[model samples]
Target: MKKENLIFGIYPVIEALKSETDLDKVYIQKGIENPKIDSIVKQIESLNITINFVPIEKLDRLTRSNHQGIVAITSPIAFHSLETIVEEVLASNTLPLFLVLDQISDVRNFGAILRTAECTGVHAVIVQKKGGAPVSGDTVKASAGAIFNIPICKVDHIKDAIFYLQGSGIRTIAATEKTKNSIYTTNLNQGIAIIMGSEGKGVSNSVLNLVDEKAALPLLGEINSLNVSVASGVFLYETVRQRTQ
Candidate 1:
């Protein structure tokens, strides 16, 4: 089995940039600024590649190579464009089912939700580019490889994504505990995009305000809420049930 698939060393990572690859992220050693490095950073940024500034020690821990102060991890699956996916799905004249995540950073939860999304026949998963968990190997494993089958799009902002989806004729639903409407009652079978918040604080106010519907899963238990992943499953399967019926 391939135990590790990290592309370390500055040159190797730079070379990977030329090929058709989805890079999860790149780590650059702190305080190392040169023209060559600056140009490479610009290239990555231009390509919408995510980069992280880290200590050299961290790079060493990631690999034993003479990394020359850079490391890049290849994503298990290529990412899809939110606009393209929405346009194509809508062009099919079918009601699109999209899942928009705002600030959910836990890898396991992200992966688990993605697995449920694929099984539920979701068209795409939309996430904010920043403050989101890196789609690493662990996420791929946790997702049971569902990440490869489903479309995932990283957006600069959730609110912008909401507006874009709305303009594309997709209804945005915010899943929050504060809402009185039940998820089961919502029309998930239609052209819908569900927005799920972070595990810690729930959805942001800005994002929530833009949602066409704010619904919640019924809390029959005394806990008052469910884990984000479990809640996501409930929400996604509800859509599946509605569409099948």
Candidate 2:
């Protein structure tokens, strides 16, 4: 974590939240009771920022300075809104190609996907605010600075984002082994959004139900599944190939 990316102390964190700063996550000391802490909790809840309760020892490990039982990590890049990005893409007269990440918690995987998306000319990447990986220095490095080049929208839920994409005439596709359709068979030249699930769990049942199509990469070897990043690259490049041909 970079020093510039972290804002510690209770009052400072509260002010940052009030000022609408782009915070990745907030860490609060567990079992701490104070008026200011309560106020901060209320504001964070209202803002829908991800918060974690940790022990004093954990806080001590994070910083030696007086943290006042709270620390907020800021995102390196400001998140884009799904609706705004969609509107802009529509106005641009180009096919809308979006990548929706479902609970991809690994920073490296997230960064790798962003790199692939950028190389493939994806219009935007959408992720759920709570479960997705934070945009940190590690992620920026893993992305080969491609994270800065692409637009990332952090929504409250993946399912809602799928609904919005479908309503906007964008076909939503899920990449999972559970599906019978192969990526090679799917038409990706049209406006589409691809949903890639987390490493541990495939796409959530809720999101899978809403997607317009389900496509999977053929795996003939012993491995049951490819890494999420690799799968995303395959899907993104296939879309590029389709559009180009």
Against the true structure, what is each candidate's TM-score?
A: 0.79, 0.82
In angstroms, give how far residue 22 of model 2 lies from its true place.
3.3
Error of 2 at 178 (Å): 1.3
Best by TM-score: 2
Clashing pairs in model 2, backbone N/Cα/C closer than 3 A? none
List where candidate 1 sits over 4 angstroms from the true fold: 1-22, 25-66
lDDT of 2 by residue, 57-95 (tens): 888888778998998888789888889999999999999
Model 1 residue pairs with clashes: none
